[model samples]
Target: MMTFIESVQQALQYDFILKALLVGSLIAVSASVLGLFLVLKKYSMIGDGLAHVSFATVAIALWMSASPLLVSIPIVILASFFILKLSEKASMHGDAAISLVSSFSIAMAVLIASMARGFNVDLMSYLFGSILVISNFDVVISAVLSLVVIVTVIFFYHDLFAVTYDEEYAQAVGMNTKFYNYLLAVLTSITIALGIRIVGTMLISSLIVFPTVTALQVSRGFRTTILIATLISVICVILGVLFSFAYNLPTGAVIVLMNAIAFGLAFLAKLLRR
Candidate 1:
């Protein structure tokens, strides 16, 4: 059996593992950044809902023999718009709107899975993630999308902060609240789609939720919170990948467990301070 250091060196020798690290780290940073605003706006579950939508889109794409990432991006973006419109125009509220769409998407995914010859390995991989199976194309797509998300967030940071902390006040001051809302939804859709490749549909939202909450236990300012969350996310992803490689464990599950441990430690630190 290889020692821990030897196992990491061996894993790094593979291109796929390197790609996983690059893409996973990018996704973690983007997710954590977006998650801060989402959690503040009481829209954190939007990630979960969009993730289910991505699952359905992936299933549909597979059924048609198309690229899942390519097909899922547009559909998930549209679904994000639909969720926002449903909440604002239909008076459904955010969580209720998310739940409505999430349940429907899960049903569609199940229906598609059943209609196929059977539950295929591809579908299983998407549901639980097969990070080691990530290809060059996956790496490229993840990099491009993650870059777009992070850059867009930075470009509109102040607007997002205004809308997140006080949408009514933002609107009262003549800010385009609706446009920022849509921007957030669209960015989140892209993040969810990209993240599914690493963490899968079932666990992707954890990447969005955990780091922000953990950071909140210690950080007081918004900027500081995002900084802490991004650092925590990157560290967790690196450790998770290395540990999973060493133990031959599931990458996505290990990552989420590591995040959970981080959260527990953060909570303990908070309690100790008080």
Candidate 2:
């Protein structure tokens, strides 16, 4: 394994790797913060499902010769809205609805991608992510989306807290619990879309779930949980990128595996402390 200094130098020396590190870190931080609330709400799978849907949108965009981001954003937003509405109307398990959407979207994407020949590498990148091929546009988009997510989360922190901790009580106290809940769903869909290029559909959910899960092992307070999750995510991103570079592995999967290893270590530490 390369030393820390070697890893840092590698990240600094290669322009493509540098952009991937920067964009991946931005997405990791965004996912960790929002993922805390998602974990608490028990809607973490929403990110996974949304990533699938975004995959479908990207495939369609490729077919139509349009900007994938432009095509994906509206679809994700609409899907989130419809899912929230359907959840309220049908009284179905939210996970079931998300799974249904995920399955359908994946099927559609497979069909579309099959029709679009000469797409093996592009499809693989979407499936597993291509950190080494990250462009300047990807970095810019990740940074903008991260900023929006962070600002929105901070702006409505109290409402989010009240709703997550006690929805009935929040409603009793005149908090727009429903609004924030749906808003979170929409924002999470957007997050997933923005993250798909960074982490890929296959491993995107890891960024959403692992950091928050590890943080919850030790943190009981909301602020502490978010902060710990962010730290865990950043560390995972850095370590994952370095490992991928050294071993010539898939960056997204390595990042996610790093997160899983981090969680395992944290769990072991907690058990030992007990």
Candidate 3:
């Protein structure tokens, strides 16, 4: 068996592996941070919903011979706002709006796939993730967007926290709660669009959900929880990608399993503490 050090060195030799690590780590960090706010605000399903939307957009992009990231980004961002509109104007509940958008997107994707007869890449790859197939261009674009998500969160940290924890209070205190809420939704949309490449359409939402929930089990206080979640997210993505490469397993599945295991450990720790 290859030693751990040897395995790390071997994986780093491939440009594909290098790209996966760079892109996945950046996405993991942004997802974990945004996830903290989403989970706290009880809007976690938006990630999953947007993931499905991304799938449809990917299908559309592929059918048109366009780049998935280029097409999915703007469409998913619009879908995110549409979800918000549904809840505010139609009085549809958040989950209901999510379900409507998610189901519609999936249907559209299936229809498009059937119409086109095929895509350049395997549909399963997009659904389940195969980061090795990601092109050099994707790595650059994903890196830039990931950093945008992270920096925006840091810059608006206090305002986001205020809006997340107490929307009514935030509004009363002269904060633009509506803008922040939309901002949160837009950020989630971008993260989900990028995350589809990391963990696939099926498992991408888990990247947004698992780490923060796990961190909650083991930590308290907003800042502390965010710190722990970011660590867990980055570690899991790096290890998961490396492990899958070494073992020839499915990359997305491995990453999600790592997250599940971490969640289990945190849950166990919570039980023991109680």
Candidate 4:
């Protein structure tokens, strides 16, 4: 058997692996940052909901022979808006709105898949991830979208934090709560889309939720939590990718499992500290 170092070198020789690493790292940072706010505001399920919407959009795009990324992004963003609208006007709040949309979207995706190709390997890739099939175009799209997420979060950090912690207080203080809420939804949609390639529709939300909660176990301040979560996410992505490559395992599942391990460690550490 090849040594660990040799195995890593062999994996790095593949272009797809390089793209997966770069894109996965970017997605990790974006997801972890956005997740902090989502977790704080009890909107973590939005990522999962949007991921399912993207699933349907991807199926539709495939049925029409269109680019899945291009087709899914806008549709997913619109779905995010719809969820927000439902929450605001229909008395469906948080997880209820998410579950309603997600359940419907996933059902639509299943129907489309059945009518089109009956759940082929390509569709499996989107559902469970296919990092090794990542193309240059995928990398470029991931980079651009990830950059947008990072910059937007930084630009609106204060407003997002205020709204996340206390929406009514923020509104009372002249903050545009609605705008920021929509903004968060939009950014989250983009992040979820970017992550679909790396972690698949089924597991993308783990990237958004796990690291933040893990970091929260050990972090005391907001900025510190963000920093720690980002670091944890990046580390998990890198290590998980490497481990998956070395063992010929599924990248998304490995990354999520690593995140779970990190969470366990953090939880234990927190218990010890107390």
Question: Estimated TM-score per prediction?
Answer: 0.98, 0.95, 0.97, 0.97
Off by over 4 Å in 4: none
List of clashing residue pairs for candidate 1: none
For residues 1-274, write the lDDT of model 2, one tens digit per residue.
3476676676678887777778888888889989989898889998888888989998888788787777888898888877777788988788988988889999999998888876656776888877777677767877897889888999999889889888899999888888999889877877788788767888888899999999998878999999999999999998888788877788888888889999999999999999
Worst 10 residues of 1 by lDDT: 117-126
Over the stretch 145-202, how does candidate 4's per-residue lDDT look in tens digits?
9999999999999989999889999999899899999999999999888788888999
**Which residue runs does candidate 1 get wrong by more than 4 Å?**
none
Error of 2 at 15 (Å): 1.5
> How much RMSD separates candidate 3 from the native structure?
1.2
Overall lDDT per candidate, in order of appearance: 0.94, 0.85, 0.92, 0.92
How do the residues 27-120 of candidate 1 rate in per-residue lDDT, one tens digit apiece? Answer: 9999999999999998999999999999999999999999999999999999999999999899799899999999999999999999994547
Task: Tell me the deviation in Å of residue 45 in model 3.
Answer: 0.5
Compose the digit string of candidate 3's lDDT tens values, residues 1-274.
5576688789999999999999999999999999899998889999999999999999999888899999999999999999999999998999999999999999999999988876836666789988877998999999999999999999999999999999999999899898999999888988888888888999998998999999999988999999899999999999999999888889899999999999999999899999
203, model 4: CA deviation in Å? 0.5
